[model samples]
Target: MRSWAEAERAEVGRARLRVSVLVALAIALMIAFVGGIAYVVMVHAQETQVSRELRYNARYGVPGIAPRCAWVFVLEDGTLHEGDLEVPRGFPLRDDIDAVHASRGSIERDVKANGTEYMVLTAPGADGTTVQAVFDLRYQLLDRAHLLLALAIALVAGLLLAALVGLTISRRTVGPWAEALARQRRFVTDASHELRTPIARAHLRAQVLAAGLPADQRTDLDALARSIRGLADVVDDLLASAQLQERRDRVPVDLTDVAEAAVVGETERATERRITVLLDHPGRPVLVGGIETGLRRAADELLANALRHTPEGGRISVSVRTVAGQAELVVADNGDGFHPAEAERLFERSHRGPGEGRFGLGLALVREIVTGHGGTVEAVGRPGAGARFTLRLPLAEAGLPVGGEHMTGACP
Candidate 1:
C-alpha cells in the first residue's frame, strides 16, 4: 500500500516538472521574440534619422565649411569637371569609395574597420551641383541592444511571478477532491465493520433453525432460509464495497488461482439450482493485483447473477488468461441475454434485471472491488444472446516491458 501511494506521488511530481519546463520555455521564447522586434525597429529608426540630418547638411553646405564649393562639379559628355579643373573622381562612381556625391539628395559612404555602421544621403546642391554627407551609426545599434536586454530581464521576472501564482491556484483547486476521496474511504471501512456483526449473526441463526425444523415446517423454514441467504449476499457486497473505498492501493494476486477457487465455490453453491460450472485456465499463471477475497467475491457476484438469470442446463464458464499483456478474467454464460444498453448501468448500485427481485448491488460491488485493485470491469450483453463480464488487471512489473505498459487507454 505504501509503495503504491509513493508511486502515485512520484507520478504527480513528474507531471509538475513537465509543466514547469513548458512554462519556462514559453517565457524564454516570448522574451526573445519581443526583444528581437525592438532591436530591429530601433536600428531602422536611427538610420532614418541620420539620413535626414545628412540631407539637410548637404542642401545648405553649413557655413564656413572648407571645400564648400571646391568639389562641386558639372557633368558633360559623360565626364565630370570640378570647378573648371579636371575631376579627380569619376563621373559615374566606385561603389566602395568613401566620397559624397549628390543627385536629388547627397549620398556618401563612410566605412569603419571595427564595430561601427554608417549612413549616407545625397541632395541637390545650392549652385545646381550635388552635395553628400556621411555619419557613423554604431552608437544607435548599441543603445537598442541595451534596451532590449533590460526589457528581457523584466519579462523573465514577471513570468516567474506568474508561474508561482498558477501553481498555488492549481493546488488549491484539486486539494478538496483529494480530501473528499480520503474521507469517503474511511467512512466505508468504518461502516462495513459495524454492519458485519448483525449479518453474521443472522446467517448463524438461519443455519440453526434449518437444522432443528421438522419436515412439516421445513418448507416454511426453507423460504425463510432463502431470504436470509439473500440478505447475506447483500451484506457481503456492502463489505466488499467498504474494503474497496478504504484501500486506494492494489494487492497483487494470481488470477488463475483466484479463478480456480471461484469455480469450486460457485459449483457448491449452485448445486441446488442445477447450474453447471466450467472453469478454464490458459495453463500459464497470470499475475494481477487485488485482495484474493475481494476478487473472489466479485467473481462470485457475477456467477450468482448468471445462475439466477440462466435457465436450467445452461452452462457457465469462467476463463482466466492474458490479453495484450494484462491479466484478463471473463465470466460468460448461456443465459437469456440482456439489453446492450443495460450493460453500462449493470454495475450500478441498486440496479436489477427484468422480473428479477432485487440484485442490483451485486454487480455494483463487483465493479468497486475491481476498480480499487487498479483494474477494470466491464459487461457485454445483447438481447437474446449470452452475456459476458470481463475484468482486466494491470500486469506485474516483472511481466511488463522495459518501462512498463501504459494504462491510459485500458479503460475509462
Candidate 2:
C-alpha cells in the first residue's frame, strides 16, 4: 500500500510537471509572437513618421524654423544659407546637395552618427535650388529599446504565471482520476475479501457432498464441486491482481525455476486429467527483474490455462529460454484453441469467448503483472489448433548464457 501510494504520487507529479511545461511554452510563444508584431508595427510607424517630417522640412521650411528633431539647409546660387541652426556632426551633406543640384533630382538616404540615427533628404528648394533636411532618431530608438525590455520582463512573468496555472489545473484534473482508481481498488479488495470465505465454505460443502454421494450419482456433485472450486480460484485471482501493483519488492527471479515450479504444481491435476505436460527450459536460471510472487503467479496462470484447455492425453509445453537480452516464457497447448483475431482481446478483463468459455481474470492479471514489470505478453493461435502465450521480460543481467543448456522432460 505504501508502494502504491508512492507510485501514484510519482505518476501525478510527472503529469503535473508535463502540463506546466507545455503551458509555459504555449504562453511564451504567444507572448513572443504578439510582442514581435507590436515591435514591428511601432518601428514601421516611426519610420514613416520620420520620413514624412524630413520631406516636409525639405519642401517648405527654413533651416532654423524646422520642426522638432529636424534641421534644414538650403543651397541656392552655389551658396549655403541656414538661419543659425545648430547643425549635426555631419551637416548639410554637401555631396548629396551638390549631387541633387547637378542631377536636378532628389537624393535621400539614412546615416548613423553622433550616437543616433539620421534621415537626410536633398531636393529642389526655393528658386530651383536645393534643400537638405536631417531628422534625429534618438527618441525612437530609445522607445524601441524600452519596449523590448518591457517585453522581456513580461515574458518572464507570464511564464511563471502559466506554470502555476498549469499546476493547479493538473492537480484538479488528475485528483479525481486518482481517487476513482483508489476507490476501485478498494472495492475490488473489499469485495474479494468479503467473498473469499463464502466461496471457500461452498467449495468445502460441495466436496463433502461429492464424497458422500453414491458412485453412480457422484458425477453431478463432482461437477458442482469443480464449479465451486473454480469460483474460489477466480476470487483469489481477483484479490491477487488487485494487490499486484502495490507490491514493491522487485528482485531478480529465475524464469526457468518459475516455469519448473508451475509445471510441478499442476503435475497432479495434469496426471489426473490424463494430459501430457512437457517442461522444457535451458535448465539454468534465466534471470529477470520482477516481484517473484507475481511472476510465479503469472507462470502458474499460463501453464494452468494450457493444462485446463488441453484434452485428455493432449500435450502442454511450458518452455523458458533467453533470447536477445530477454527472458521468454512460452506456454503452448494442443487443445481447443481460439480464433486468430481474438488474440489481443483475450487479455481484457472479464472477456469471455463464445458461450462464455474463456479465461477471465487469469490472462488479464498476467498482462497487468507483466506490463507493470515493463515487459510484454503476446497470444496467438488458430481455432482447433491450440493456443500459445509468450511472456517476455528483460534480462536482469546481460550475457546470461543464451541457450547454454537445453533440457526437456515430461512431468508425471
* Candidate No. with top lDDT: 2
| Candidate 1: stretches off by over 4 Å | 1-113, 116-137, 175-179, 196-254, 260-277, 282-290, 301-316, 322-327, 333-412
lDDT per model, in order? 0.63, 0.81
lDDT (10s digit) by residue, model 2, range 154-197: 99999889888878887888778778877877798789888877
Give me the displacement of residue 139 in model 1, in angstroms.
Answer: 3.0
Identify the candidate with maximal TM-score.
2
Q: What alpha-carbon RMSD in Å does predicted model 2 have with respect to the real structure?
A: 7.7
RMSD of each: 9.9, 7.7
Give lDDT tens digits, candidate 1, residues 1-412: 3222333455555655556656666766777788778777877887777666666655544423413212233332334433443333332233321233322433465445345555544444544554434445667767877887787776778578657754664456545654565576567656756666676666567667877978787765666665555455554444444453334234456788778866765665567667788889988777775455567678777877887778877888899999887888999998887898888988788887776688579888788677867789988988767899999988766633222211121111
Question: What total of clashing residue pairs does each candidate reach?
Answer: 9, 0
TM-score of each: 0.53, 0.66
